[model samples]
Target: MKTFTVEEVAQHNKADDIWIIVDGKVFDVTKFLSEHPGGKKVLVKMAGKDATKKFKQFHNDAIMQRVGLPMQIGVIGAEKKEEAPKPVAAAAAAAAAPLTPGKLVSADEARFGDGFPYGDPNWYQDWNSPYYNESHMRLRKVIREFAEKELMPYCHEWSEAKAIPREVVKKVAQAGFLNAASGAGTNPSVASLLPYPLPAGIKHEEFDIFHEFICVDELARCGSGGLLWALQGGLSIALPPVMNFAPEPIKKKVVPECLAGEKFIALAITEPSAGSDVAGLKTSAEDKGDHFLLNGEKKWITQGAYADYYVVAARTGGAGMGGVSLLLVERAWEGVEARYMDVMGMWGSGTSYITFDDVKVPKTHLIGKLNEGFKYIMHNFNHERLGIVMQANRLARVCIEEAFTYSMKRKTFGVRLIDHPVIRNKLGHMIRQCEATHAWLENIMYQIKTLPEASQPARLGGPVALLKAQSTQTFEFCAREAAQIFGGLAYTRGGQGEKVERLYREVRAYAIPGGSEEIMLDLGIRQATKNFEKRSKI
Candidate 1:
């Protein structure tokens, strides 16, 4: 915390003893000149000078935190400053004034983070809203901080390794993130069944669906879709069927272990033959007197290779949706094998092709009734699609945030990127789409809360599906536009454009999963038509 004067910093101008000020913090880069990616000439040019403008022109906050902070020698001392202009001073005074009257929430208390404007939700900037409260704010802060400290720094590293370390996964579980992310934290019955408490010390009764939204949204802020999927994607989809419909014996054995992070699970529904056609899945489970002999091949199963168990959908009778049944299959059992698949993105998710060669699943492990798994699967889609909406929407925002930040610091044609009308137009589209999708998402969340649980599938499914498509498409548009803004830097794997590059590669992962955009668009209209007819009493 030592302060250095401008005169004092000027004394270290030599190449062997260099110092520069950035945003009032002094960094002694004497030893780092050789390691500077921009080369020694740039550092030498800024030696013993305020390089705040120059440094930001080529670097980002992540680079600052990772490389610059460590070399900090001291901060620039405060000096005499110019007085504020009359108009600016008056505007500042008015803006700082207290709420005129009847403000529901204090500006300071409702504000969530200091991120860039629109980088977070409008609620984060003290905008009035009915959906969130102090409890939700508490959970947001906790998860955001957790993601920043535990996940963001290592996202690229883990994605490259294609595996998240077990210890970090355990920490996430211990913090109650698993329960929240799984859609279980908001369900009272499911919450009672799990061992973990709601995150941020909110009791089960106080933890509403919006809190669940916050959990997924904040974690996605890490800007690594692979890491987010690897951690919770499979469990969120797989565990719910068990929690909602499995036999008592199966629930007793499987739910606790998975929630505790002692085991992992994947939803093995998509087969090579069936992408969106869940009914066409060819996996079969023949009934025996003692157990079900399972035989199938599951493709593109998230977390499949790393999972200890799988919630599998297989044919139990005839050859369509009516015949499909969900079963909880143990990975440790005989004849079960999983091998990782090389995919375009979501590498850290352990996407795999799994085979079941005469795997024995106890009859007790059957989820709900035989031939009734289709209903269970259908019921689960609302939550799954909503989760996708949460992730895709935030990831879209990450694109806006990264591109916008870069546009500020990066100059083009003798001006900042934001100063270009064409660049602003692209950013405008990204912002508009992202914000509109977010509003739609929040509305769906509100409907989920107000509508009865049993009525939700019928009432909310179509809207959720459409929202999923909207969000992923928004994510896609933002990723592409952000890449355009970053230009060559977005093509690279790391540095200032790391997040934009990674997200651009991940656009397909979001769009194709949780129902493809084409499928969702049709389904939304069809479902809405059916609902409209029913509402008219026709």
Candidate 2:
């Protein structure tokens, strides 16, 4: 491009031929005057002058990169000054120091875990950890790579589409991620459903709850609750009951199909009139000998629009918890209706409102014993709560990472934002919550691992519920702080603060689902006290 002198550029000062300089670059924005989001008057006032200050005040780097660069005519000659001379001693010191922008550090060299303090679990970056091993690290690398390369780049676009593409679901399944996600990898019968082997180094037999936690954590790094849920949210919750309690034939038929990514399923428990109060659910299923006549409506059903099957909860007997029963209602059955719901967030998860009008569910599809569904539901809550904890904590870390990176780059008052004490204080609070919640999560995971399966619901439910509340609260705080840090950028969508904006919208989704914060707090205390009484002689 040809350079222009200030004197030479001063001639075109009229509206017909106007030129403005921004960041040492000349732009011919005359044609864009009418097209600018701000009216033409604004552009006309700044015509034929350096508008860097005015432009930056109203626009972000994304706007300039997308629009301003295309209008550039030439660089301003006065802005092209040569590098200043450095002292001889300073030059020697600079040459010996590491390169600017830093060299790429491989995982093998340091296992530094993204090099951000509290960006990941403390153990991830060589901190002493009893839970994670080489296999866990390998799995973490695999998942992180897949998320960054495949999912993160397109998450915003997918969220806008309001549905995760079927191909993406299949790819995730084919990579054996769904198997691990749904707790199928450890079950030999269902493990065979996986279309591919576990990511190069990971072994199916070795896969445990911690591995599942890692998968959830790594996927949440993509920073879109919608995308994460769209892919596996339903599978993680709905399929477990089938594997654990469904009849062998039904399990065989449904598990393989769902795990193979050929079909989908969702746990239908929450209703329009009932949430947190499961016993208050009014969905009814009348006995009809060979099959039950299921008639009810389920709201906030994640992945419901695309599900091939629904593990629905309905009232089978008189009243209260004793009356509930679990039924695997197939979507193809008559009178089954599902439509997409426009929720506050998690748009791509296909959250739906479903109606089952006299739908026939075979007796064989009843999960566990009849009228004993409440027990099964209670058991599932522990796992569900843990899943919520994992995602919420990771999302909290994501806010930290976003705000931290942005603070280092964004400047104010002639210094980087991080140099400000108030900003640093906000970050300190966010990091402390994140790290404390993560530690609690890891400790809970260890307890879940050591405790026998039959005893888990009673022993760990309270703690997990408490952790779930803690993590979600932390997530809410971090999202708010990140928004404060990014200012206007965090308010707008699809730019540098894209994740922050999206995640901020998603805060309530996490807080309310799995279990609401208020309910969780109450239940945590109630369950803990009951368990303690049972264990104590006094």
Question: What's the TM for model 2?
Answer: 0.81
Predicted candidate 2 versus true structure: per-residue lDDT over 1-538, tens digit per residue: 7799776667667777878888888888878877887788887787778888787655545456556788999988844667885543343233322222343333343343567767777656544566765567667767887877667777777877888889898888877788777767655666655666765357778887788888889889989999878888888889888888999899889887887788999999999999989999999999999999999899999999889999999999979999999999999999999999888888789899999999988898899999999888887788788888888899999999988988887889999999999999999999999999998988988887788878888778788888999999999999999999999989987767888899999999999988899999998899888878888944
In model 1, which regions exceed 4 Å deviation? 1-21, 26-51, 70-101, 104-110, 535-538
Clashing pairs in 2: none
List lDDT for all candidates, in order. Answer: 0.86, 0.83
As a whole number from 0 to 100, the lDDT of residue 529 in candidate 1 is 96
Please give the distance, in angstroms, between residue 161's alpha carbon in candidate 1 and its true position after superposition: 2.7
Tell me which residue pairs clash in candidate 1.
none
- lDDT tens string, model 1, 379-451? 8898898888899999999999998888887887899999999998998999999999999999988998888
